[model samples]
Target: MKVFLTSLFLACFLLIIAPPLMAVVDLYEFDTESQRQRYHALIEVLRCPKCQNQNLAGSDSPVAEDLRRELHQMLLEGKTDREIKTFMVDRYGEFVLYKPRFQKSTVVLWGLPLVLLVLGLGIVAYIVRGRQSTNTRKMSLDELSSSEQDQLKSLLKTSSEETETPP
Candidate 1:
């Protein structure tokens, strides 16, 4: 019983401490402060293909680590940000970028929201104008011309008389 308890306590302790020990932190030395800033910025804006939703800087997946290493190496090589982005796009396709460039292929992705919004506003405006016209055309008894008032009285009298008669 004592041995079982000891083993259980030891397993609990190891479970508690193992996760922190397993997390890997990258420490790359840059030649200049600008290179370091650029490296950090690029990682922040780039998505991890394996993780889908997490950016490179936030993901701990092996693919994210490899991409971070590749980005650091590219910075050391003095590649422009555009060139690095181009290389990544070429190798991984455009899904690796957090903000894809505007191109013919992406026109619908960018323009659809604006088109939908304008269409929605147009429909709303049409509905509102139609309602406004209907409201304005409705004549109150006080607003009706004398001849019109006489006609309305006759119609109401006939309607009431018809309702009072059988069938």
Candidate 2:
């Protein structure tokens, strides 16, 4: 019983700790610190094609692993950042890039927010102006003609009398 308990405890501990120990580690050595930093930043920004929502650095998908290796190899080959980005873009389309380039195809992505904001403001302004005009046009007692005022007074008197004496 003692040996069984010890083994169970060891197994539980391994289950809890082994995952973190086996986490993905970058094994590539960059030519310079700047290259290493750039590699880190690039992985964070580049989305995994297979795991659409996850960045390359955080995704454990096979595609993410392959992309990471390709990026590392490109950096080692003395490829500029722009060249590497273009290569990925050509291969995977704009979806792989977190910050997509501004082009005819992607203009809507960059411009839609501003367009929606202006449209919303315009609608609000129009509604406020309409309300203001309606408020201003409301007929106050002084604005009514003398005959209209007399009619209104008679109507109010009848309404009050009808309310006071229930049907």
TM-score of each model, in listed order: 0.79, 0.83
The regions of model 2 sitting more than 4 angstroms off are 165-167
Residue 44, model 1: Cα distance from true site in angstroms: 1.4
Highest lDDT scorer? 1
TM-score of 1: 0.79
Please provide, for model 1 over 13-102, each residue's C-alpha lDDT reduced to its tens digit, 9 standing for 90 to 100: 999999989998999999999999999999999999999689999999999999999999999999999999999999899999988899
User: How well is each residue in 1-167 modelled by candidate 2, as lDDT tens digits?
Assistant: 99999999999999999999998776888899988988999999899999958999999899999999999999989898899999999999999999999999989999999999999999999999999999999989998999999999999999999999967
Question: What lDDT score is found at residue 87 in candidate 1?
Answer: 93
> Which ranges in model 1 have alpha carbons more than 4 Å from their true place?
1-13, 142-167
Please list the Cα RMSD from the true structure of every candidate, rounded to 1 decimal place.
4.1, 2.4
Clashing pairs in 2: none
True lDDT of residue 151, candidate 1: 99
Give me the displacement of residue 39 in model 2, in angstroms.
1.1
- TM-score of structure candidate 2: 0.83
The global Cα lDDT (0 to 1) of model 1 is: 0.95
